[model samples]
Target chain A: MPKRYVSIWFRYLATDLHSLCQPQLKSIPFVLRSPSHGRMLITSSNAIAESKGVCQGMVLADARAIIPELQVLDDRPDLKEKLLTKLAEWCICFSPIVAIDLPDGLLLDASGCTHLWGGDQNYVNDIGKKLHARGYDAKVVIADTIGVAWGTARFNRKYQVVSTNDHLSILQTLPPEALRLENETVERLHKLGLHKIQQIIKAPRASLRRRFGQDIITKLNRAIGTEIETIVPIMPVEPYQERLPCIEPIATRVGIEIVLEELLKTLCGRLTNEQLGLRTSILKCYRIDGKIEQVDIVTSRPSHNIKHLFQLFELKLQNIDPGLGIELFLLEAPRVEDHLPSQEKMWEGSVGLEDVRLAELLDRLGNKIGTQSIHRYLPDEHYWPERSVKLANSLQEKPIISWRVDEPRPVQLLHTPEPIEVTAPIPDYPPMLFIYKGKEHRIVHADGPERIEQEWWLQQGQHRDYYRVEDEEGNRYWLFRLGHYHDKSYKWFLHGFFA
Target chain B: MVVSKADIFKGLQTDLLRLQGLKSVNNCELNNFLGPIASAFPNHSFPLGVIHELISHRQEEVAATSGFVTVLLSMIMGASGTSIWISASRNVFPIALKAFGVDPDRFIFIDLKKEKDVVWAMDEALKCGAVSAVVGEIGEIDFKTSRRLQLGVEHSGVTGFIVRKASRNIGTIASVSRWKISSLPSEKSDRLPGIGFPKWKVELSKIRNGKPGTWDVKWFDGKFFPTHVPIDTLVASDQWHKKKTG
Candidate 1:
């Protein structure tokens, strides 16, 4: 039972970039160049350019002289590396272990992943198809070992799949460079009249190690099944959880609170030292009667304040019942963030914006009303009413763009613009009367249609013609015509209410 | 500073009032509630460290009740300390409170889904010594719940306000004072713009062994002005208008 490893080589990365970013250059010959000692050298070339006598390491002037219509681009190895890393991350969907091979390759330890996609053939085929759909021409090979997979992906023309029996036969045809060796090592092997891996297969091991040193034999052993390969995985984030065990079951709520306060004291110390704050925490009270009661609290921002955290916990404590007694308590911080220390002390210790009192208020409010419901909005640079306001991430995040106070915005804006029936004269005039939610309001005072065109690049939709109108009862409303008056899809909508 | 023969009894009365939690402002504030609203009470001032209940029997009257409470809350809250406002619905806009010259951030607004939690949270907030004041917008509060909150405020020396909607049972609860507030049409103005200064007809429905009467008050700028318009005068003015037309 041999393990299966999948290897993907971005053989034509430069051309694939051209196809992904600028699809118009897909059929043309593309070449990437880098400036070397004041002279441009070709870093990579597409199949079309290679077929037309263009090669990497060639002088740009000479390559251009051979194919005058070749598209030359600056070498973007950073972009290529980022693409490879992203592709490796994407491969985690198929296998839990995926490692990046720098500059243009990825290796997925597809030990158990192949059977999930039917078989080893389909597993490699599905990945290759997905990459191709995303404008990448990938060479995928699934073999018994990583070295065999790498050799097959680069050297084999059609059959890049290699099993245990076929791996040796495949290695016989591929060059020594297919084993991923240094240029000097491959050159020395070539000078010894051994260009293919099969030529060195029957060589004496002791003489090979003594003459060429250990590197060549090591490479040989790695290519064969003699040496083992391992991959390092991306580490997952560890949850911040602390557990406390009691000697005896405690029944009093005050007893449980005392334990909680002690636990929080220790946790806050660690969090502050690490400059981290908990956004959500859960206090699990395991009672001796086999009952588990948990109270969770969320903060508006990342907070590690012990007093504020205790007050928020105190609000939800009534929901917790001690019952017979409490045996154990566990406090878990599910969401943590890097929190920069706030300005708690103002001038001469005067209360400032980030006061402890304010934090307690926000935390207490966040517990009663959901944290999601508490929102502080700032103006955004958008003419669209829906996109005009953006929510602030924290209380201290000041708005760079000022609110457009010149235009009177409604005090209460509906989460969504509601459709309403309107009765008005001809095109684009303010509605004389409107019916919203089956209630009719006769408009008395009206303003003009302040037409706002749609941002077509962001979304293709109708332009809104907004009108501020006051009803007979002196209630003001913000109304808009969904699309252009000439368009057949035009409709009326009530957007918000004025104070 | 001398203790006269008659001044001894007057000193004894002042001391009695002070013992019943009557705190007098050092300076005269004719513009605020300390001038007129305070004198309308049995202690010759609004009693401190007690839960005050305000009833608004209609949807429109809730505004007047909140507006009237905002005036008292600003003074009781002082320039320091945080306030806990436990409400079931987020009907009172924070911006509207700002119009009353109050910083909305100074208040902790607890929006509970259940009415019982509002009372419980308010009671807990009242008991917390650090909190300066607590406001609970609840529906029906029984004597048991009211007495508990009353005891909490008494122990903590904090003030409490229970704002009930129109449909409350208003039977009897252990409260310092109970008032029914209704909004009145503001006076027509030629200077100020937007909505006029909030005017309310405050009726003292119940006060614990205290004077119960009605008063007309209006909030303008940052002060409360007592308008001298009683129920009899209003009816007399209507009769005079009919006679003049006839």
Candidate 2:
């Protein structure tokens, strides 16, 4: 069956955030500019601003020139993307497959979802009404092809639900830009007096190809129902899950063991065939007495070995309560990764990430503690000690950035720096004595202050001048003075304990 | 292989005491650890398939305990299998393990926020026979938790290390051995610009079938060497000292 695609466009997406967040900006004429950077072009304009001839890509200077009292605020692309992703996730209720169409639109695969709430037209009206009620201006359109839905949603005056068979006739009335061509291509087409899609469709394909390359023809075909275009669904159609139901409830350990073995055989076989391995698996036992118990095990590395996974479940078997006996067993893999093909060693036992023994051991350790408890860190290229390290993604991933041993780092770094009282005769020199948590320590061995400025662009924070100080009693402390000495806000803080 | 009743009686004395919980636990295997530290045991090796408890009362003592555990871990992880180190407070730096002759990558580090999770992870790590050993830095280990850990290692033929921080009860647990390690001021070469080899005073407070003793050892040139200081001379200093005096 031909896929039914729905495209919803937030016409004032960039400006809508300010309207939603500020509320007062809804009716006022406003434009978006860089919040912290030098003044520049206008990214977007509110409906009121647009009515007054202010539009996106207009120079901030020109917008100000047009409307002297117009308000211009930061156009936070990061915040906009975050909001767009959140909006797409919200639209998952309508259709399981929802993907953001770059800056402002959303694509939804609504093939079988039209009959759920109502018919296709009612579904569009329902979504549009709901979004408009939420202070958003949304234009909804449904077509057999993504290109038609995308184009009609933006250019059409009303909500359009074009049938797959008639998509070509309906799309031919729209402008050439609706074909998703670059501005220069659209303008070049307009220069040749080919203003509409019908003109392009009627024009010779060979001549169009010669003028604007093959982009226009391909896009035009995609906009209609003639050509196929694939849309990558954001979420998978189904999660990895397997279940076994028994007519008779199992109470004995041996019985449960048999069921578990059967489940593992199937799960592992499927995973192996797919070249996939699970990092986390959840086993649910549904008892005849309406009681449910679950036990989950996490692995440091992805694995599908039947015996190893069974052993992990075996450890958890005792914890599962067979209240009136369990009648159903459900196994689900929440986290899985591709088991990439590699050269296997002749020996049964191999070292490192690919080692089955290591993965089994780590799985047990991770299951008992919780996978989040395990961590490995790699050096990051930053002069600031705190920013110099990052959590390593996996055990196999080698650190591209090596540790900076030229400068000593503390063994134990405090989660937050603790302020300490420091006294010295010379302002620029290291502290002669520092009182930390009501205890005074006389510094015996001290290193020079290494000034590290905070990366202000990331986050604004005080600069630090670090000193490695060893107390008279052999206790080493990492102390840093905040900001420049001339500033009255300069203070000392203990950051870490050296090994 | 001669079955002498007298020799058996003498051997069973410690084994009987261990079985009754007076000592640590039963010795399931005769495989001793590597280096000079192993000679301090009765069979010239640390007992396998049991949990060894190490207590460090001071913050600096934790460093010594880390070094001591790293050295033993290298021996226990000889040739095969993986090791995991679980800690409640993440203080052990991975890069520092290289200095103690342990490849940081060979072990998995589990840092838990709650002390309970640390124990749970240790128990799980211990149960997996594929793992060679596990080291947990927790504040306390109850008698029941330790018993479960002992049973886990016994069934899997894995070794476990329990690093008890300050403020823990020095009461009895199911571990086969109890140790206390304190920094002994690393040896400094006369003409060197930096500090020399790491030195630690390792005290065996409790051993199942082995005698209890204290010895100062040095990790020099990637090996353990017993210092000239005799074991008995360091009798006043032990994990039990603070509790007994205070």
Candidate 3:
């Protein structure tokens, strides 16, 4: 016993398109026929047509002569292909793996899916009811082989299940035309009294091969599920789905929020089931008329938490203008990934609620003033005293640990070093009383000579001699003068104030 | 600028009320210094609720002033929260402040656009009441503006430090505690085999209710202990002075 290959063929006639295109054909006696075959291939009513002696492959002119009111229309291949694509999309409801069968069919590997719709018979009935409600006529057939299913769908019946052993007995009753053989082979078999598939199977293989070639017997054997036929379905495409089809178009902020909650619930549930989290979620609302309104939010980390995720969107919801009313709402996580939960005790302890609030405030401010307007200072890891900080935005992700400096620093640092016209004797001497802010104060007492050597590696290095000096009022200041040269002009800077 | 005898009595009363743990402008200040600086500076200690101006005419001035402020703040670094440094003009060198054990980890530097912005940010930081101190470098100051800031610090109770960089001379009218800092030649011999520690002279331009003059000081081995305040010794018998006092 050879291993079997089961192929289930799902055909959608696309009656919707047929009805739209052939609207005038309603209540009319119309027959779709092959131009070359000259027959009533598909008649609206065979009862009426049969009373007048009209049958398949009857000459159209003869059929028209028999029934003068007969209407013959040409087939549109483009329309049929478009309908097949839609049929493929509908089949995706059963499984993510559904591929289009060119012209008018879909090939689904419904092996594991039969139990989902409650067994094969119920699944077929359910699909049939759905299609019928949607104004489509659908047919499904399951067999051990692709060839048998193919032969069964067109040659068997509207509903079929050709089991392995019963395939031959069932196929034997089918006419030679049902084998889907080429015209030459069928004509050759017609001369041999092998009009029925059973008679063709009964004929001696050697004689059949001699007369009609091995392909006829081989095709016959494969069609009856004897020799296995494998089908390679077109690979399924990745889906980008986000749906919020509202029952009623919403127009107010409260209503929009309500709809948003429901949409987020459904979308988050789907993401959770798939074990995925969205990094970027875009909500596109289609207005009742035609225009589309969209809002997008990005999370610092991939997240699936419904409330936390909704909070981010709510902040942005204030900007959404609910113009007219939204008929369809789509929440799409265009970028998603598998979300793994990570505990954050370190950040929770180190960062205060004020820090989070400040970050949020900065984000809102940036949105209003433009993201480029807001800035934050980040410490630069360098030996240079003044050039140890860089500016960054609040939204930009950075390690919080780097924000802390490694060494002791000042309580107050000046914005700029003011040039003081000092009358100090030497390069290393602290300034006596230099004119500052245009007032003269005699240097009655002084302390310091903390020398900071130049960082020789950089071109902009400065040698500074810092001091802690007091004025007549007993005020203390942390000041420094540069050491660029022997008699370099002393630039006075108040770095910080003493307690 | 002149505090009357009645005002001194009032200040004493205020201090007494504050000592009783009453939350008032006078109560917010820390305990006075344990040494000579206690008499030299106003309020026995550096007042907390006041904007002290450290005016230096030259860049070398920051080192002189930073040395003193660093020594003063070394005791307060371990406390929670941070002291903010707002500098828009790139005057304060962070590493220079770091060398004095001011705990850069607890210091946050904010750079603003304009002088007015720096002042505005300082005012906001003062109101937040979380930071220990707020410091900024300003080039210009009027008497009225300084008075306004002094009132602000008094209300918020956080120390405010304004480093006013003067052009040619020390501006006497604007600051509560004004100092003139100048670099001094290292006291250690140049003939020494290695580079010696740097020394400086800090001129006390204004000391509220105390004498004002220059104090000779040396910052050696990264520490700033007063060097000129001589430890008087007994000439004949080293214990004679203590015996006399006893």
Comparing 2 and 3 by DockQ, which wins?
2
User: What is candidate 2's TM-score against the reference?
Assistant: 0.56
DockQ of each: 0.10, 0.21, 0.07
**Across residues A1-499, which tens digit of lDDT does each residue of candidate 3 receive?**
3332223333325333445467765445555555555433442223335456766556677778878887666555366556666766766787556656554565665667767877667766676677667666556666555566656666667446666677677777777876667899888878878767888777788988898877888788778656765445545445445677778888898987887888888888888877787777888889988888888876544567777667667768877777878888888888888876555555433222134333333333333333443344556765444666655333333534354434333434556656655556665655677666676655545556777776677665556777765555444455677654456454666565442
True contacts kept of 3: 0.07
Q: Estimate every model's Cα lDDT from 0 to 1.
A: 0.75, 0.77, 0.59
Residue by residue across B23-93, what tens digits does model 3's lDDT show?
34332223322233345554455555556677766544654665655544543333443566665665445
Q: Write the per-residue lDDT of candidate 2 for residues B158-209, one digit (tens) a residue.
A: 7889888895558778888888877554433343333334566778888866
Cα RMSD of predicted structure 3: 18.1
iRMS of candidate 1, Å: 5.8
- Whole-model alpha-carbon lDDT for candidate 2: 0.77
Return whichever of 1 and 2 wins on lDDT: 2
Task: Give the lDDT of residue A316 in candidate 2.
Answer: 85
lDDT of candidate 1 vs native? Answer: 0.75
Pitting candidate 1 against candidate 3, the one with the higher DockQ is: 1
Ranking by lDDT: 2, 1, 3
Residue B158 deviation, candidate 2, in Å?
3.4
Residue lDDT tens for model 1, A1-499: 5788888898887668777788777788889999999999999888888889898899999998999898998886687777777777777887888888877888888887778889878888899999898878899999888888898898887775687788788877889888788888789989999978888878899988887778778777877878987877654344688889999988887897898899899888889999999999999999998889999998867889898888889888888988888889999999999988976544433233345555556567668756664555556788877777666676566667655655655544566788999998889678889998788988766666888888888889778888977666545667899877776788999876543
